[model samples]
Target: MAKLYSKKKLAEAPKMLPKQETIDFILNYSKALKVVKTSNGTYENIAN
Candidate 1:
């Protein structure tokens, strides 16, 4: 649940997008990636 929140936060962070078409792609793609919980209670994306 925390991981999901963090991903949502990251997706919503202030960042410049070059094109409006890419916004959905970025948010959906980021949410789709698998993340692992670290020892420090943070999350890290698992590389494909």
Candidate 2:
């Protein structure tokens, strides 16, 4: 969910990284865009 990645008011949020398995889950389960992390720490959306 987008809420999972949203910033909280009081505490610092934990950093999230997307792996291949996670991308697969997103593709299967949700309507969210699939994204992969690059070596330089940027995200690239996976094409459907």
Q: Which candidate achieves the best TM-score against the true structure?
A: 1
Residue-level lDDT of model 2, residues 1-48, one tens digit each, is 999789678987899889999898876755555666778886856455
Full-model lDDT, candidate 1: 0.70
Q: For candidate 1, write residues 1-48 as lDDT tens digits.
A: 787666544366588657867888777778778877778786767444
Question: Which RMSD does model 1 reach against the true structure?
Answer: 15.8
Q: CA shift at 34, candidate 1, in angstroms?
A: 1.5
Per-candidate TM-scores read: 0.34, 0.27
How many times do residue backbones clash in model 2? 0
lDDT on C-alpha atoms for all candidate structures: 0.70, 0.73
TM-score for candidate 1: 0.34
Q: Which regions of candidate 1 deviate over 4 angstroms? A: 1-17, 37-48
TM-score, cand. 2 vs. native: 0.27
